[model samples]
Target: MRLFGTPTSLKRMVPRGLLGRSLLILVVPLVVLQVVTSVVFYERHWDTVMRRLASGLAGDIAATLSLLHRYPDPDGQAWVTDFAQEHFELQLDFKAGEVLPNDEHFRDALSEELNDSQNENMEDVLAQSLSERLHRPVMVDMAIFARDIDIYVQRSDGILHITAPRKRLFSSTTYIFVLWMAGTAMLLFGIATIFMSNQVRSIRRLAVSADGFGKGRDLPPIKVEGAREVRQAAQAFNLMRERIQRQVAQRTEMLAGVSHDLRTPLTRMKLQLAMMGDSPDACDLSEDVAEMERMVEGYLAFARGEGTESASDVDLVEVLETVVARFQRDERCAVELIGLYTASGERRQAPTTVRRDSIERCLSNLIGNACRYGQRVRVHYIAQEDEESCSIVVEDNGPGIPPVLREDVFRPFFRADSSRNSQTGGTGLGLTIARDAARVHGGDILLDDSQEMGGLRVTLHLPL
Candidate 1:
């Protein structure tokens, strides 16, 4: 059942990192247990102890009063005072003419502010106990002196002022109990933090290794040094990496052999067609052979996405400028770079680790396709520092693919242009190859309508 806030709001309040959440799990219960223990101790054990201490002090005072009443003469009263002070450790003083002050006056003259609720409770308990025993108005102030409690009792003659040691009513065990609880809690929390950090370190290493691997960066196997579950995950990741590498190696080797074999026949056909040039049938046959060769090349490029290229730290803006420059040389279409500068008008650089060849090829395909379909193409580079990513958007003012076919156009040999015209499109593998290159580096290509250009917009997003 939902309680305080909506589920979404509660989720936002929760810690996003595993370590923070784990520590919270440990701390919350420890805090709750300590709170409950303190409440129970104060409610039952501590309260009972305070009451007993107050009652004992009140009994001593009542007994002293009784002795004073018995010996009303001056010499007798002085002896009783000496006896009470020696036996009960109380300093007694008598005022024959002075009457007990009113509540407000007494509070102003004798009471001092207490530091905590415990002292206030102690004062209340002692005052209630004295009033019950002496059958007279009484005022108790613990804060009047550092080590003494000032208690005033109203009598018919005057007032009996008693000075008792603060230790008689205040328990030292309360502070000891609280300090012990806090010290132990802090000790346990520190221990848990150390152990939790060790466990989280292993998980963090695994996550970083996995992210690098996905981005096509080679990394050594991670050390499995955490709990059983974390160790198992690291083991699984290592095994998966080995299996995928083996499969890719096998596929590349097989395709290499096929490419070599197919090129020989195509080369012979091209030479044969050159010898029989100018004949209509030979020219038609040469065109067919060339089409076959184009299709074969497209298939190989698609299968060998990134091939064996190593990733390196490259400036993405430099790569985009190179591609744009190449397209600019072509008079068939006009291309422009929109975002090569920061908002402050200084030149910007996007430095990230990526396969340079793969990214270049991907950009070539996307821009080449746009230039082919439209007269003007605009390339926008958006660096999203907060997201730890960047995007290269290629927009063209061409008749964009319909919403339904945008996804289908990414399939190999599936062209939006149904005419199968070689002048318009080649083997329908351009988008497929571009997407594969992007995905090889743990990025993706997305197609949407361009708000500015009113045509197709292709955004290639890559992690920095």
Candidate 2:
């Protein structure tokens, strides 16, 4: 239900988490792409790089041993060891038995003791353990044929036949590639955030401007920006607003002219009727003139209030109470005040204030119309359960309005078959005036078949 020409609903389709939603849409895909690409590259290429580096180190160690064998020279072996250490921190360990030489210094320190017969048995035990653990042949620190020479790589794991180096022979270009991919992803994410923000901001501006226009303010024309669709929508809204404003202005002018023209004849008729001398028909003439004047005035009032008015904050509950009170006073009808309501889980009162005077008049008209048409009128003032609005229901137990006439009852100069020619006279403008007032407040009046009373029920709803 509405006050006069108001929409009963105020809802928007856009979700509250629009920005977060957009960011998620953008960010999730980028992250997934990076993860997938990195995994695939690591498996297909990175493992191969590690294996090649291991093989190259093995080959380098083999060549060094061969060179030492050819020269039987400590200087050459030392030179090769120094070169390997400088490049990849390779430590040359000669595994004799379980007791491997720790380094060159340890080898020299224990040489004499190592040559004893008892030490030879200890060496045999070490060599047996080293041969089994290394899973391959190993060289001992002795003349190539004099002692089993085992050059085992020294590492966290006791000794391995294969050499371990500090760094792998992986391409520097691969690191650069990964960094570039990360940089590109971040850049895209930033660009997407910017674009989405701009789009949403444009929509926000459009919404604000529309709100201004709805309030009857002359909002500055919106500048189209952002995505093409959004810009187009803004342009369309501007054009539509202009068109609506022009139509409203034209309608106002037409109503003003028509009302003026109608009143001229009514005025003329009243003046002529007043000029008549005192007679039996004079009373009838005055009544007819009065009714006509009332109708014309009502039409003008309804049109003016509904079209030109702007809404303001109105305490809808208070407005209903006031209107119902006035109705009770004027017609001496009993009105019931139902419970006050709070909306959205808040204890605070919900007040819907808009065009106050217009809404009051509309309520009065509806209630008064009911009183005239029905006996035992029950006027109820209750806030709507829905958080969006409040309601006023005026119900009566009379011979209800016919279904055929219900739709047309709100038009100006329209009266039901049970009303227009009745002994109880009316100007046939009550419902029209009420509906107009409803529209002005951004609400509406609805006629329903009263289930409890088995008569007419008129409901008025105004938004909070």
Candidate 3:
């Protein structure tokens, strides 16, 4: 079940791997936190600080205006400027019989880099505070200076212009706050990346080991690391591997011992039959001994086919060609080779890594069964490189097994030929051994009715 986005398209937009999803989980929340913090500061803290500073600056301007109005003489204006500079730390310039033009011009091109909604909000608060304090319309430009602010206040006869540092209405603490927040978030994300990469690396190694084991290949040892659960899973997989190997070994040994033990009595019986060779009873006993030997050999072969061989790169087309060439040598039945295919329905020239001996044994068994039962057999091979899957299909124009007994054909010693005819020469174990071989390579063989041949169609599917 998916717990993230509801829609399938939305889920597709999400990353498929653990590390990508984990990074998304980390970064999205950090981005939201940063955005929320910025909004709160602009809405509450930034506006409050700007309003207080503007009010203080407004009082300073009012005092300067009062001094300028009280002393209208030139000498008095000069004295007022000196007093204001000493008290307010503002550079004030006064001109009589002159006025700052009421142009009311404003620079509207805000810096896209530094200007945002919060910056505009602070500008509005400062403008409102100064307009109330001065009791007249005033134009204040903040962007004209990076470290200072300019104030234009009109006097009765002229204009009073003051240039003050930006500290009067803006806060430097804002820069420090944002810088620290970004630095902290980056450090956290860096740590998360390192941790997630380590965790994912462990999982990747585990997957490689599991895949190798499935393909009947020898895998390098897996070192348990990462989270506790991952380590536990690795340990469990290792334990399961040990149990499977032990079971295979036990079965192989038991089958070998049983076959050896039974062969001794059979060898004695064959010797006894040789003594009475001329009689019909001796000939019938010899036939029984031969059939018993065949059954024993079939059982042992089936028991030993748990893929003791390692997987290797083999050209599937070459493998099919070799199998077809072998069957072509036999004159009893006509074996035809259909085309080999890839997932794109194109001919493939690349080698597929697989258990060559096991796959060959599987193909030979299936084809052998097909030719043994049918007068004509066909082999078709398909490899889907992109999907990492391959299939070998064998069909025959023989009398197909009844549909009800199709699945039962794979059971040991359960032959469709219940009469056990010498012509068939089967111990009812060929398909079982073929299936075992296919499964050892992480593949399977299935039986179905052939629509074209009106007979049996066997498909072998393997994942690369």
Candidate 4:
């Protein structure tokens, strides 16, 4: 997520791409469940609240009607008027057959109920509740029934009345239902997007960092957080990376020490050999000592990873050309450079730049091996079918090596038949060093049958 600095953060969110896939498995179903739950919960809650509100409203209306009927005196009327004024709007119109005695107190009570509340119709809520209770459509509007009681509304100077024998009150269910639904949905969505994205992102970071570590890149140590399981995974990955790095460092140091110590004996041997002189066999002994020196130097250089860190941009074409030229100078070996060009048909193009000296050494080892074991050798530098890398192929015309021995050829100090044959020089470290160099450059060399040349084919590939 850090955008401006190193590529450390810009690496893909998951190492194997499965972390994002796993998150999708977890989150997609959860989101769907939440949505379904929200809808079902809202509807169920609305029904329960609406039913309760309807019962309360019906009871209140019946109780108010009873209080009005029983208390027909002025004090009673005054109390009724006070109740209506505080709670709702109502009207009382005495029928001729059921007349109330005309009194100032009763008149004041009637007047109070008339002037109490703002006159907006509650017909819609009442009708909806009625419809739900009856399980059939019901319409309520401003109207008066029997003249004894007038339940009506007046707005904008227009009197609207509702007079039903069975009174109804407005249900409060709609307010509660809407509020609950809106709140639940907002909460669910917020938790799903923000909280889940963060959890999934942390997991993705851990996976990607593990991948980068495997590929020999330094990933920032994972800082574990979030849910318990995710944190555990991150912590485990960090520990594994540290362990592997330490082991690799130890191995590299051990190799460095071994290479350094070998040089001291080699130096001493050189001095001892230089002193041998004035004999008929001295010339042959000196040549043998010189060969021993070359072998020792090669072993030391190969063991040290060529005295360089695993980095450097090598011009691959120059490496191939230089190796071929070196063998060309050795007229005893017939080395031919085949069509070694980029896929783009650019004659002077090199497909990759890697550790220069290491790549050159790898090429030289392959060509030298071919010359020693086969009659003719040809080297090719070109792109492969995948179009993402370059391959170097060294093939020859002699009888090919057995398939079983091909794999063994890359082992350090592994010679095919016996101790340094006439076909191969001293110290069987050539293929091992070559393979290691290719690996350090994020490439590899593979041995196969040379179908065209009827011998061994060694292909070295490096990433673009």
TM-score per prediction, in order, is 0.90, 0.64, 0.78, 0.54
**Backbone clash numbers for all candidates listed:** 0, 30, 0, 4
lDDT of 1 by residue, 283-361 (tens): 9999999989999999998887665777899988899999999999999999988888988999988888999988999
Displacement of the residue 184 alpha carbon in candidate 4, Å: 8.0
Worst 10 residues of 4 by lDDT: 108-117
Report, for every candidate in turn, its global Cα lDDT versus the true structure: 0.86, 0.65, 0.78, 0.63
Residues 1-464, candidate 4: write the lDDT tens digits.
Answer: 44655575445433445445555555567668767865676456544554455555534444555676689687996797668545754443333332233433222222222221223224333443443343322223334453323333222323223244333332355566557766776676666667767787888788777654543454579889878999999989888878876776776788778777877776776677667765657677777777877786776666566433444455667767877998888767788897765457666555454556677778888888888877688988676677667788899986676787777767877776632233645477888899997886678889888888898889998776
Superposed Cα deviation of residue 48, candidate 3 (Å): 2.5
What is the lDDT ranking, best to worst? 1, 3, 2, 4
TM-score: the better of candidates 1 and 4: 1
TM-score of 4: 0.54
lDDT of 2 by residue, 270-316 (tens): 78877886676987988878877876787677666555666567666
Best by lDDT: 1
Q: RMSD for all candidates, in order, please.
A: 4.0, 12.8, 5.5, 13.5
Candidate 1 residue 288 C-alpha distance from true site, Å: 2.8
- The numbered model that scores best in TM-score is 1
